[model samples]
Target chain A: MQHYRRTEIIVGAFMLTGILAIGLLALQLGKVGGLGEKGYEITATFGDAGGVRNGGDVMLAGVVIGRIKRVTLVKSLKAKLTLEINNGIQLTTDAIASIRTKGIIGERYVRVSQGADEQFLQPGDEFDDTESAINIEDLISKYIFSSGSN
Target chain B: MNGVLNLFGFMGRGLLRTTERIGDGTMLCSRAIGHLFTPPWLGRQLVIQLYAIGFGSLIIIAITGAFTGMVLALQGYYTLAKFGSESLLGSAVALSIIRELGPVLGALMMTGRAGSSITAEIGIMRVTEQLDALEMMAVNPVRQVILPRIIATLIALPLLIAIFDVVGLGAGYLVGVNLLGVNAGAYIGETIAKVTMHDLLTGWVKSAVFGLLIGCICTFLGYRAVPTTEGVAQATTRAVVTASVSILIADYIITSFFL
Candidate 1:
């Protein structure tokens, strides 16, 4: 009986440790996505979003500082994405946000390679200069058709 | 005429026996589960069985999960590298582990390690008339012996899968970043963006069903095994084989529902 109780204690501790580890990993993986975390919103307008998805990461210098909150269509030919960024990081008024793919054929996310400007952008200010994700299928078809025409 | 008649009779007997066993097993599971929800939950037995089943198997689970993850990264890197998309290895590993391998492989490990043991232990008790002794004492043997084990498996299997997922991700990360030279940012970021709660929940639900299947099948086989040493050994083997096969089949059915 005593041995059983000891096993119980050990097992309880083991399970608790495992649960804590999973929780930490889940959060670190950013599955929570700023549900209750403090962040500021910045909207960026793009000529196209292609495969840029909502809840995707907004990265600066290979590090994630925010997530895409929403992707909306304005003027039927362009996309506007609402990005939720952490409070401490400041974006310059002339910063550029571009939709970038994770790999050759992977999900698209927004990367801000150079956001360093003398004048800083505010919460509601939009980053007008943006690059959209290149759809491989579209590019291939366009090439095939143009090559055939020539 | 006698030879042909004997062959036909043998075939008929085999069919009848198969149906009989299936019916008896169904009744055994129903009665055990029907009694499971009642009071007098054997708290001590549950704790003991939980330790025996869960804690006793952590090392094997860790090894299995880590090796599986490492192999996935190695293979996925080579395949994705053809397209210069090796950085997607993280998302690929995470999705595969969370959605398919984690629960299925974890349950298979349990079937081999714990399911066989449960069948043999209960079979030995039956052979020794220990279960009969409890019956004479007016104690519900099913509740005492089976319910706790069922509850233990139900709780332990999902958590085991969760641990498998975490260990798998870590192993994949180590292999991808250190050995394969995939960019670390793309690996982690794509996995976070792709895998969601829905995938995790599907795996958990499958684990629960697998737990119930393993727990009931092992206990029922042991309780009904022929009371002999050879009988107990055969029962143990059968328990493992049956539990493993059923887990795979159930996984397919559940995946179909999700699709």
Candidate 2:
């Protein structure tokens, strides 16, 4: 009887540990970040969004405050990004949203530079200033041609 | 001549035996599954089996996970450093462990540990005529004996895989960030960023399927053993080998669909 009880207790502990492990994976390590329904939406357009993927980070001063919700091509043949920013972080009308790569060949993300304007952009409002991703090949070719010409 | 004809007859019998065995195994799996939800819940039997399978195998699974993660981090650092992207080591370790090694290696280890024992236990019962006695009493041996084991394995294995993944990622963190001097935030952040819910779901599904394979194959092999000591030994051996090979084949097929 004692052995049976011990087995039940041990099994219960094992099951608990397993459940905790799964919860850690789903909640902490997974990308189902709590920004699902609580964030404010804003739009940013760029000539080239580069490899900025959906659910990519939106960083402000190197801190993530939002995620890229969607990426679509506008009628202007440019990229339009829908961003879901956290509720408390406010963006001004003059804030500059730019597509930037993390490392040399790392993932692409949006970096927002805060502007000094007093007016704050509302939900669904567009960022007036947007910078497209830098093409490293274009920069290298231009540098080589200019140096050769010189 | 008569020699050639005898050889052809042997080969034909072998092919027929293989096909018959496959059909019996499939029927065993379906009947056990059907018996799983019927009356006489056998909750105590399930708890005992869970303890035997899940708690019994925890240490070995965790140790395997740790070493696999540590080695993966070391190798990943060596390769990714060549490209100056050593920061991706965490994601490398996490993805490999969560997506493949956690399920495959854990299932393989469980087959050797719990699975072989399951086959051996049932085989011993058969050798002693215990299963036949139960059948004589009008009790379905498949329901009385096999159902608890299959249900316990199905419930225990995915939990074991979850524990394996967690332990593996922790060990990888120790090797990658603390030992290898990779930036701590990047190591952790990249792991969190790169591993999505979809990846977790894939791991869960794979582990569950592997669990089913192990339960059915091991139990079926033991339930149908020749009721002799030597036959029981052979059945145990065959159970481990067949379950391990089936897991690999199923992993490839499941991964193809996911990809």
Q: Which candidate wins on TM-score?
A: 2
Interface RMSD of 1: 2.8
B134-205, model 1: which lDDT tens digit per residue?
A: 999999888888778888888788777778888998999999998888888778877876677667768778
lDDT of 2 by residue, A29-136 (tens): 664557256789999999999978877889999998888889998996999999999899999999999999878887789999999999999998999999999999
Global Cα RMSD, each model: 4.3, 3.0
Q: Give the residue spans of candidate 1 off by over 4 A.
A: A30-38, A41-48, A59-65, A69-82, A91-106, A111-150, B1-26, B183-186
Error of 1 at B218 (Å): 1.2
Supply candidate 2's per-residue lDDT for B259. Answer: 60
For model 1, the local distance difference test gives 0.84
TM-score of chain A of 1: 0.69
Question: Where does candidate 1 chain B have its weakest 10-residue lDDT segment?
Answer: B192-201
Model 2: which residue pairs collide? none
User: How high is the lDDT of residue B31 in model 2?
Assistant: 91
